[model samples]
Target: MAYVGAATALGLFAPRAWAQEGAPAAAGAVDGDPKAFGPERHGLSAFGELQYPADFPHFDYVNPAAPKGGTFSQVPPNRSLNQSFTTFNTLNAYILKGDGAQGMDLVFDTLMARADDEPDALYGLIAKSVAVSGDGLAYRFRLRPEARFHDGSRLTADDVKWSLETLKARGHPLIAQSIHDLERVDIESEDVVTLRLSPKRTRDLPLTLAALPIFSKAYYSAKPFDASTLEPPLGSGPYKVGRFEQGRFIEFERVADYWAKDLAVNVGRSNFDRQRFEFFRDRDVGFEAFKARAYLFREEFTSRTWATGYDFPGVRENKVVRETLPDLTPSGGQGWFFNLRRKKFQDPKIREALNLAFDFEWMNRNLMFGAYKRTVSVFQGAPEMMAMGAAQGPELALLEPFRDKLPDSVFGEPPVPPVSDGSGQDRNLLRQAQRLLREAGYAPKDGRAVNAAGEPLTIEFLEFDPGLDPHVSKFIAGLKIIGVEASIRMVDAAQYQQRMNAFDYDVVSQRMSMSSTPGEGLRQVYSSESAAVQGSQNLSGIAYPAVDAMVEAILSAKSREELNVACRALDRVLRSLNFWVPAWYKDSHTLAYWDAFSHPAQKPRYTRGAPEFWWWDAEKADKAGVKA
Candidate 1:
């Protein structure tokens, strides 16, 4: 979960990934600045290559002529900030309080918008153009004169300045940590905003800043910016909060006169007339709701449901369509993260032993129907950033200084999760885990291990719902085999958020992916500073000088190649440390929805271009007996 501005990467959420497809710029890195900020650039990219020029029409991935006016509803694909998969209790998605409602990103606009077809390139959305300083620490954004909020008030540079200040001061800790290096925001004019960064800011800080959500100074001035509230905040995006309940469902109405609808950056996007998000405390219950058309769409996350649960009447009558779309973004990071804040999990050996106890090979076969591959790297699906074999060339050079701090295995071979013998209870692996526990000064007896002080090494697997009960129950049995006292704690969505913010759990599940152009966002999840922040995403409480140094290398990288090298070096060190029991991943998204929607021929390469690019098919909707 990376709202560290990821609501598809800004406004209310934090940065996640900025990847796309485009040929590299032939002019080379403009100003030798990684983002190609040379002379009133209308677009920005990590490697200075931008396929879409200033005068370009709509994005290649969109259908400019797509008809709008349809209802696209589903469960939230992924969540960040205070969002919950099962339930939500607040419309305030940016703060660290109640369970935030999904689809809040639709309510606000950013200074710039991402071109989904080009990796890491952001074209002007609300901003007309942007210019960067020679030192790459200052950015001047020229906002569109016509940009106006829902209440028809002109969105000025003043709003941008106030939003940034408020987010830094009272937003979620993740947002605060990601933008810690932002020095100041200077409003040059009503339509112009200048941002000054610290000299030590990350290379991608400019991009992250551009993608941040702009909030109305007037709307927030009359209300508390940090507390959760059911009242929707004012927004300037293509959609506005229409009708919503506290926790059950929320809907966003497309702005009939959306100021930027015809803009090149927004053409053929946000096609849904009404986008709705539904809540179900359980995955099985949600599936049943989809069958009954309680919601019109779903992106299936459970492998067993995809494999065997689609024999309902809707599927039999051809009213529902099921297909797999390729997920091109980096697998990012997904696993059961260990809370290193706890002393018992501070030992790397014990962490590794805990990781070894899970039989991924067996889980893939029996539980997941062999639909996923073991996620081995934090940059799991991204080849450029995944560390394989031994580090070499600039990657090795980057790690050379931290050799003494990192394990020797990081220098020899990248750590890989142990392959089980396909047995859920692999005795050999269990024995290996037991031996590691003993070496770590733990005594194993009676299916439980204790430290030298006789304190039982117990781990509470924390979760908000029973969606993972089958998987965790099996994993806990494996932990018992190795004398680790593991138990699962199922809490409500509200309690889960509170405990996560307080860092009170021994272990919790988290899934975060990276943008093609990774930068400051990584710091929110791995930097030592974030580890100390209460509501930050550094779930493992990673606070190491070596890791900090690696994060710095990533942030300061001057080229895509340099960034990849830094990521691999960091990945090597993280794997050796075993902060998580790496989970499984699939590169394709399994989708099942009613036959009431149609989409453009080409889908955005980086984002899950669903409701954003999908239009209503009146004929199909009639056949499916659904309301459009």
Candidate 2:
């Protein structure tokens, strides 16, 4: 129930910088007096500030003075980096531009970009500013006349037209559907481009347009747009692709004549002089490389590592520092997702019963060593989390669509914890579960819950990583104590991805990055069509009429208040389904960095996602002892 203060209320309110008839605001000056200058008055500080990476939020941090030569390795044990084609579809044209990864930002620039920390605020990068018509049916973007592709061709309205049309032409149906209302594109002039949308108000238009990465019309036209070719991607961003040694390293060097370099949004950001991403198949190797100073920072897991791993000689010498930033964003939607496509698990009672069996307290203490906490809801620490804490009178109105099909118990109150802590089960909960099981046509035979078909009530746990063994093992043991025949299955990341794409598993242990915008994400996790995308999303296999309607209501929402209503309604349906047995989240992000670096005094206002605006401080990094 914490409220954002007035300062933060106006903090993100930046004027649209695009659609201006003149040269884009000289690189980086947004909040400034264009006339204010000179060493006598302001100590010769440039119009804007620049600082090292990790200075911004939501972006991958790049060290400001880090040499352009070293390979920066990241170990993600969950999925493969190499996928020729994506099975899932998205409406964001940017998602279709490159192989979707945290590192892809190196090669693309969106019309309006988000600072790493502030996910909601839009900053101009491609288009200088964008203005929407009063009726909300038209949007205009003015390109910077100075902007040019990596190949040196001037960026124009034609590129903007091509980017939008190309997305519709080549983007998956699901991706194209979001922009289906985009009726026409008009090149008003050399720099101004206008889009006329269908009369139906689309709230996601700005978000969709902000996500489209402008490609060089000349570059894409030289050859046909092919997803398979790695033909040195050209971009107009602050960084350009340097080297592409497949499965080895991807390097991006700072753009010397980057046109947008002086913008307020870009100043004191992207401080990293050179950025390199090293890919590793094994996490252990990545961590080892990090410990050896092969990488500037490494986020460590495994209590044994956090508590004892730092005892290395490097730690004694203070070669690295470990820091934790409590989870501000959702730690990701982690839970046992049920595949509703399967008939066996179609019963609401079954999903409810399965959720009730977990002893999160015991699992947190005994198995996790207090390293984890139970997930309260999706988007755990976000401002608009539609969780139990925030559901109220208006919120309840949104859930009425599914009131008839869902149990009062699901929406009535949150479940109570068992009586004993790891010692014994609560008789009352057990009795209630037994009643529900019997009501659902399960019979108790020889102390086992079995259906009339003589099938034991069993649930399979599908986990992808070997790293998850300890946690999944503990969960399986808990299910056994509850008299459910829970079994665990382990598969490699690739195989697990394949199975998930097919919805071939009964229950899955998975995670998802939640967006700050609730409506867009709510649809991704719960909509009916999402359930059908195979591996597109909706890993829980959810398909419901109420969810679909709520999603539409949410997207059509005009004001924040209306969006809250739609969001809360969708929250109730998801909570009632218990599709996710939420897991714990770090209060803040954990980051390790070398000591020989300095950044802007301001706290980051963006995401901790990698490749952050660290390169902004490149001009002054050497003074901070960063070696290039």
Candidate 3:
């Protein structure tokens, strides 16, 4: 209840669906000096010398002039972009813990970024500098004098106050739940905005405050918040929404007379003349269009088309340029999800058995065409990933208390014992599965698993969106080998959402995109309270106490050590639960683009997924004869 209450206070009313998520370009050969593209690049003109802060970490960077007009096509999910009034909270970007539906962050601006890697931090945007009170209850934001919204209205303390107060009152329950104390937004003068909160809410204030998306009171007051109408969404950033077509694409035009055009933070970005997003319903169709030169670039792989079906002579002659970026992007977890709400899968043993039945080695090589990497824990191959510390000595000490809550072997070395295949077609894993099912009150008869009272144990592999339908179908074939009767039923986007919200799924396959913060991720995935709630991210429908405690501790952790300790404990408990069947990770990005484009020699790190940091070179683009 404490978890739910706090989440509500911060306007986090609903679990976020999957959404478009970015990459940076490495400073390579350019027409200008490489250092010219540092964070300070935008603040200086073409002739000015580059500047860097003393404390700023050195990053592989690039700087290019805003390229001429060109259109970038992307595949968008079928969902309503306008969520403010459609049973979804629009103002709760920060409080919601998952990758939200489309257009949340793209349309709005947050007070601060979730991490330092991304540029959303308002160092020179709206707030010049920020200071947190010693007790953490009070936060002071020093507003930049030149900050103004798209409508040319100067951003003031009232706008910030109104945005926060309005969200606290009318925002989602999750948003308002975390924020307590009816403290006032004290205007400490024209340039200073001080937010004072009660002591009870200061514990996790930074995480919550980091989510606040300060809106212009002037723009919103003129017209009510309505999803049906795409009135120019007010923003204090360098880009503003110019045009939007329902279920299509939204175009953002640069603010020509923008206040922060020369701001230090605004430099080196918004370099495109017009950022136009083209939406496609399917990825394959989009890829074909990319091959036909309809779009700027496409992430291609050695699938049926790339391996054998490249009939286009031009593309064949000038083969798609391939490059490998080393250890820069976050290799996200992509796999099938076991919905624990189904009584058939409520037993952890059954879930574990399902995980052991398939071989990732064969699947990646044959089915996936060697495009994926095997993942053990949810956070695999990530730096300081929780899985890295699972059975490590000191990390085990943190998890020792939950030995009873988890499998005994989990706290000991090697975590959960690996399941072995039984010999003679009745492998050790099959025997173990039979044992576990019997313990869960299942009986086997005539090569079929039956539940209590002679009902055949049937599990349906559900797919709502057709985007993942084929992959789900391929997985169901694997399940059949293990004597599980599995099938796929693809629903349209609307129906898929309805069924998902009702918790009407058996074994659903989904790719859960994670954030940089493990605390935020742990809450969304394994919390007991979140498991039961409709639209909750705990899609597994698991309710475990030890996992819950670790999640809370991780959320409230102050330093890196506390975070590491809590993460290891939570990982052990979650793996023992076995609610999720480990799947594959996309190791390499298979992008195919027209010959007209030249990319940066060095690839920028992708803390986010991919796409945000890619820039267009008008010179190379024109030389290649590509058009908008």
Candidate 4:
């Protein structure tokens, strides 16, 4: 609920420069003067002031005195850019051409690093400090004097400039689309870099630029930056690529002489001497591997496995431990997203029917063992952004301008997905769906639904894993009962990614994690521009002008209160559009790991700082007879 004061309400990241204290004497330049420069600030946040000040020794979420030395291995619980949870074929993780490996970012350093304890605050990592221009269009970063790559080469501001330009031109479609507003990167010297943004840039662009991975300009000069390759690129981070089998596993060895290891931002983190990720195409197989000690940690995503599969020998003997840590991050949009580009899914009326057809109550009780709650909003986990009973005050005013272009529900009580009568086959809901389908010009002809033009109303639910077949089958069954033809089409993970990038699937299930301090990421997920980008995350292909306008409102919000109002307005609009059949989300991370490790007293508010901040518990490993 904190709001930035009027003096700092420029919609720009607050200024912070590392190790630097006071500002130079000013010539009395006013606030709006383009020549005016802010004081050196050690960190930046989306809005308001930073959580940690410049002189803080280490993050409060970390145990700064904790010892380092251990091996932590697990399957990747989350992925970004081009990473795949199943397998990786390329070491180049920032492009769109390959199934990129997880943890590659561990080897690369960004100008600034996130304080996982805070919503969107970032502290200096490679850059010792950061400062912003008065007009809010430029950000200057001063590189740390000791910053060095794995090869002991001094990392420079020129490298940062090259990275910005290269990524904008050849990075993944999502990355490219997100950073398209970066006008230019000006290298003031080998240590200072200035990034100038376009006037049309989003409010969070400075943070985005600061968080971009710093690539070694020399290492990539000989190698093509756009190709898929197995060679590990040079980086100046805490870890470097260590051992790997192309498709099975990849390990990162902790850099003994890493330049920034003792920096406040990294203290007591990346504790393991070695970090590894084991790849598996199936969840059940991955679980079996965990039982065999193939991986030391597992963050369970399937509710059924959490309910029944944990009664193994390891659990009974206390060799394995489970932690139900609360996930305080936003569980944004998790659902079966309809590809709005598809002709059949263009009608909101039809999409609503599909949404109403999902029997979440019955599924949660029987199949999921009553593990989850039915999710309703695109901004489900972020309460600040979730639309409640009705729009009023700021939300209503912000949305009133687009009233004619939006559904009537935007002005009324938000539409909640129909509550299904716990009979897996809810006849009342099915009948209601049938009515909507009929109104949309689809009706039963010879026992199967078809449009007036005689086009059959069929939907293919695309999926990569067979474990979800049971879930998909039940939904298809409900659709069949309502006279619609629906079936599941299985594909491998790589194929699935390719199909998704090409927007070839009819409907696919996905979960999008949003920042508690939401900003520019909205464009990459819901904007009209992203809808046309091949590999962008706009899975639903949403391109409505109203949606784009709502996204702009969010970006332009100067305070936390304004941001909340904007997000709720967006949530109202997105829910009204019915672009997805909303799914379920649990606010807790169901973590099952070997009892061979121990962690800090507190977990980061925004991240599950497991294996990373966790050092090996020597006595626990010995007592439990588990492999470290």
lDDT of each: 0.81, 0.55, 0.51, 0.81
The digit string of per-residue lDDT tens for model 1 on 1-628 reads 1111122222223232221212233222475665554467787777666788789888998888888888999988788777888788788888888888888889999988987777777889888987766556677899999999999999999999999888888887767777777899998888889888887676667777788799999988878998878887889999888887767888999999989998999988899899999998877888898988899898888888888999999999999999889989876777899999898999888998988899888888888888888888888788988898878898889889888877899898898999999889888888888889999999876667987888788899998767778888989999888888888898888898899889999998877767767676677788798887888788889998888989888866766777788989999988888999988788887889999988887789987799778889888898888887
- How many clashes would you count in candidate 1? 17
The alpha-carbon deviation from the true structure for residue 147 of candidate 1, after best TM-score superposition, in angstroms, is 0.7
* For model 1, the run of ten residues with the poorest summed lDDT: 1-10
After TM-score superposition, what is the CA distance of residue 556 in candidate 2 from its true location, in Å?
2.8
What stretches of model 3 exceed 4 Å from their correct place?
1-60, 64-69, 76-104, 113-124, 168-184, 197-204, 226-229, 300-311, 317-321, 327-332, 388-394, 414-431, 481-483, 595-601, 608-611
The TM-score measured for candidate 4 stands at 0.95
Task: Report the C-alpha displacement of residue 310, candidate 4, in angstroms.
Answer: 1.2
| TM-score (all chains, Cα) for each model | 0.94, 0.79, 0.79, 0.95
Compared to the true structure, candidate 2 yields what TM-score? 0.79
lDDT of 4 by residue, 572-619 (tens): 999898999887878888889889888887798877888667788888
1-628 per-residue lDDT for model 3 (tens digits): 0000011111131111000000012112124553222121111101111244424433334334434344444443222212211122222233222212344455455444322243111232466655544334455666777777777678887887888887666543334543434376878877777777664342344335435667888877876542324345677765666665644555666667767655544444555555555555455666576666655555453354455545675465664444445544334344667887777787777777667665555555555565556655655545465554337665676666777667775665434334333221335555666676666666667766677687866777666345445455555554555556777776654455456656788866555544334433445456776676555556677677777877776655554466556666666666667777666665454555555444445554433123344555566556566665
Error of 4 at 40 (Å): 1.2
